[model samples]
Target: MDDQHLHDHRRLGRELGLFDTDPLMGAGLPYWLPDGAVVRHQLEEYVRELECSAGYRHVYSPVLGKRELYEISGHWAHYGDDMFPPMRLGGGGEEVVLRPSLCPHHALIYRSRSHSYRELPLRIAELGGMYRSELSGALGGLTRVRAIQLNDAHIFCTLDQAVEEARAALALIARAYADLGIRASRHRLSLPGDGAKYVADPALWRRATALLREVLDGSGIAYDAVEGEAAFYGPKIDVQIVDPAGREATLSTVQIDFHQPERFDLNYIGPDGAKHRPVMVHRSVVGSVERAVAQLVEQHGGAFPAWLAPVQLAVLPVSEAQERQAHDLAERARARGLRAEVAAEGSLGARIRAARLVPYQVVIGEREADAGLVAVRLRDGRRVDPLPSAELLHRVTARVGARGTELWADA
Candidate 1:
């Protein structure tokens, strides 16, 4: 990696006070600091808004499930090696396990109620937690972890609707990537290879793989078809991203699953008032919140986009005389929904250096405060001409609200 892209997220994460893992907390279980929580909360809110606008209903499911649940979903048979051992509640009591994926619970949710053809493309979304029994060697920063909060969703639809639903999911992922300043390295069609790791039904595998290929082709997305990369349940189109070290990892995916519906006996009423099976389309905009944030930390080199930055605006006072003005500016920013704080303890140069990564810095000096004006410093090191505090605040609020990639709206 070149010096320009040499910043590692683990290093930046610690320096920026974003997240940390401790021996007491165990590896792969990092806790978010206050600043990190703010960034994560904003990212999650953006996803929820996007999903809700696209006709997806948010849902909440338990992190733990009965052992029979995974067995029915075939995770116990096909993916047990990666799953934690089941927990027996008490002496000779029923066993439960931390869910390895949200798909099984979602399948059960779909089976809970009878649906009609009008509701064929029922989209259910969740920012839910799942666990993986990752080997100690594989565990690192947020990129690889045992506990993951996935941005998962499933669409229950007729076979004919599966391709379109998957395509729409790909579109959503692209839109999210653009907003987050993430670039896709490539798209991959992940299929089953010669092995017993997948479901036994060859016909189902062929059909599902064809559907995903159609989705990619129809969306005008060129993809590399790779075998042995598909999930145990079905085939998928994976969106890959390159890290600073030039390694590829999946950032998002759209999968077509036919096995789970059959295993769970999921059904809906057809237009003719007869029972029919609905295909399950599994997709994630950003695979895992922690991993996504880690990628962002590296991508931006700890200076995130305005709306996603932990502290959008830092108010700096030149001296004690302007301290009150600086705080007032911060309050105004907070009122407009931008994360802002005052830095009044250190010298003006020291405070500015400390807040260099902040998206915007408002420097209040005695002259500027007396004239009701403030000098704005952007993340890119550009200092704007003095402008009225209200005007600067207005432009900043507009830029942040729009989530524009530029540091300043005018720029």
Candidate 2:
């Protein structure tokens, strides 16, 4: 692997002050600066919009769960090693663990309600923070961290609806990747492994694998089959994307589980009046927010799209005499819902240079301010013709809503 690209990203991240890691505070934990937080908030908003449009209801669950909860979910036996050590409170008896996933909590929520066949498919989504203990050496900027914000969701559906739900999940992931400018190569279908490591039911594994393959084929998506990658309880499909460094990362995944419902005794009254277990599908469009942000930064070389740019426009006054106008123009831009700011304490050239370093779309100037307009400049250093304040507002607002790259285009 060439160190050039890797070093480039690390230098850019530090120079932009997006995030920082301090050994004293412990490794694998990143402290995000205000600029970094802005990027995250934009990502959260984007994911929320996607989930809402796909008919998933937003939900939240606690970060820590009791030890018994994990035992019942089979996480204690299967994923205990990946989890942070339990905290023993009140001396010794009770133990709590930071949640590694949201599936168990969502399952408990489903069990809390009694549902009929009419409500067979229930989808819940969350943008929640999750934690896992990682070796210090494994920690990197935003890509590999101990604490991460996950864009997670769970769907509980009848066997008859499982395939459709899976298709829907795939569609959601594809659309999200397109929006983020990520290109999908091929899907990876993870099936149950060998007899020793998997449930001793060959018939069931074969049936599930066949079902997943059928679904993938019918959806017209090319995929490769891989054994031993599925969760102990079920088969899964992972969307792989190649990063700037040519490494494949599982950007999103959808898993179908027929076993978890049985483990948790989750059932719904069927159309025929008998109680039956509903298949559970766990998915995430952008698997981990930290990794997603890192990918976005590298993909665009740190020049984010307008909607995701921490500061969409930077207002620069040519001299101190133009400060009031710069502030006024910034206020107007902000009122129009664009993230705009005035650079009041730097040389005009220095201010514009600094603004270009970040992912802002335009740099306003004194000449346009005198005409009640703002001069615009693209991040790539191209100058846009001056536009009236109202016109600029409308243009910026439109680009933001559409999440278009043309937002930085010359007027």
Candidate 3:
């Protein structure tokens, strides 16, 4: 992990004005700047589109939950030490606390309505914010923090549909990783061991673990079985990728649980006209938005693709004579759903350098402006001849629309 290819996202985030944590506002909460928020917005919007198309219904949940809620979910008894200290209602009553995960609350939603076998794979998704109490020394940039938001969803399905749901989840993860241009090199079947941390049901635990392994094997995803990594509630398949520094990271996962449905008393009507418990599958396409963005910035060395770039195109005018033309071009790009900006006054080298980290750069001069052409620079340090305005726009739109990782140039 200590290679030049591996750089600290904290430093890169700072340099890019992405986010910051202030002591007065607390140690682990980050305030996202505009530049960072734009990137996050793009990531989340893309996630919503993907999940929605996959039949997940996005929903909103409250940040705080009753103490009894976690008790039923087993979090109060099994995971209380990691949670923030509980607070009493109206000075002294039922205790409430910030939610550390979205599963329990999501479980309550499934229990809210009666369901049928036909509606078996009902998935509810949320990019929910959660909180945990961490010691001061443990808090670092976005990667390790107290406050976090994750792409969380719980699937309610019959036992017969478990493997299929798991397959669907793996497909989603595969597509997401492919689009990000990163390889998910590890598929880990995380199972329970040592009756200490997980629910100690020997028979139930073994069955759940076997089902997850079957799904992974059936998909032909090579995985290593890891002991004692399953969630307190269930077994999971963790998709891990090699980060820039050669360290493995688990940011996407699919979990199957026979526990939550039973604990929450969730049931669905089966074809035999009998009520049966629905299995719960929890999955996240991308785990934590902030941490993923941090990973991405470091992965690409802070030069984001045109589609994901906070500012996709940087337009620079050589002199005051061409300033209006630059702004006009920027507006046109913006109208076409691109993030574009006009460069501030600076020397040619300075202006180009300022926009170096961005995907595309356009320099406007008197003759080129009159010719409806803009000189552009590619990420490979290749400065191409002035191109027709229509041609440049077409190329930029194609790259952004495809959300490609590289800004291609003719070598």
Candidate 4:
């Protein structure tokens, strides 16, 4: 990429102190700075809240798993090329590798105990860390990183429950995109075709693919069915979205799998008093935290909305006399849950000028400090002067606390 063609995500990431990848540390391994961590934390919290309300039970699993685990899930055969090399312990242990995906471990959790049909669908979710060994030439900023943290979840349910589960996953994905003010362009139904990559179980593939189509067709959403893009295990629905610069990318997906459960021998007790295999649905709302953060940086051009900004408010004192007032005001804003701070060690004008992505800048002078008030400066350079401190805090906090999107105004 040339200097003129450079992605804003790479430029703004350093300018805003969001994230960085070190070639010395390793290619594609990014370190999130303090500002970046705050954004990532908010993303995780938002998704966790959504999953909780949707009846998903969160869990933790090992970062490294026995080679046999992937052997059963078929990753060793189908996806081994992308994974890191195996490591063996000195105590005569079997081969293990950093997990390339969390589904295999989650599958083992389900297999650990038997369930009744009453537990028709079990949803497992996690903000999981995973690794893959990609060619150095292919690695770029956060978008194509080797190390990633996933907003991943897996659902175990009966064959009859796949359609409802798939539809529900789509609903969550749609709601999330809408809340972020981004469009989910289209649903792409990825299928098996005349390729050696796809798993060959004609009867299972037919059944699974048909059920997924039923859900998409019933939902009335426009979609394109593409062949040779499905995973080896099964077919899936890939949601396509365009970035700020008109570049398209696959941001999220819901897959129907008939292979993993069968390979792992996972079963649930049926209403007929017999054991039956459960199906698996793999889904992610935001595929990788790093990539999502990059998208947000570019989407807003580093000017994040009030709710998600790392530094929501900056308090600037006109001189040493008003320094105490500045700090007190900052504390007051913090008590109200705003990420506020007192801007110290700079001229009043310099401090305000340095407020790049800060949504609100409060400038305190002699008259305002005496009247127990603040002067609010917005990103657009408009000033709201001489407001009571309490009132100032209320307006800013309301917009942030409500998570309001565009068409938002502060008091």
TM-score of each: 0.97, 0.91, 0.95, 0.92
lDDT of 3 by residue, 318-380 (tens): 999999999999998888888899995879789888888888888898989898899988766
lDDT of model 1 at position 281: 96
Report clash pairs, candidate 1: none
Give one digit per residue, the lDDT tens place, for model 1 in 333-381.
8988888999988778899899989989988888898888999899898
Q: Cα lDDT for residue 14, model 2?
A: 68
What's model 2's overall lDDT?
0.79
Candidate 2 residue spans exceeding 4 A from truth: 1-9, 194-197, 344-346, 357-367, 408-411
> In terms of TM-score, which candidate is stronger, 1 or 4?
1
Tens-place lDDT per residue, model 4, 1-411, is 642234478887887888886768998888989999988888898889889999999999889998888888888888889899999978897798899999999999998988999997999999989999989898777888888899999999988888999999999988877666556777899888885566778987888889888989988888899998788888889988666567777778899888999898899999999999999999998778887777777777777767778999999999899999999989999999899988977777788888956888988899989988888888767777679988888888888876645423644
Pick the lDDT winner: 1
Query: How much is the lDDT of residue 253 in candidate 3?
Result: 92
User: What's the lDDT of the predicted structure labeled candidate 4?
Assistant: 0.85
Candidate 3 residues lying further than 4 Å off, grouped into runs, are 1-6, 242-247, 383-385, 408-411
RMSD of each: 1.4, 2.5, 2.1, 2.4
Top candidate (TM-score): 1
Report residue 272 deviation for candidate 4 (angstroms). 1.8
Error of 4 at 14 (Å): 1.3
* Clash count (model 4, backbone only): 0
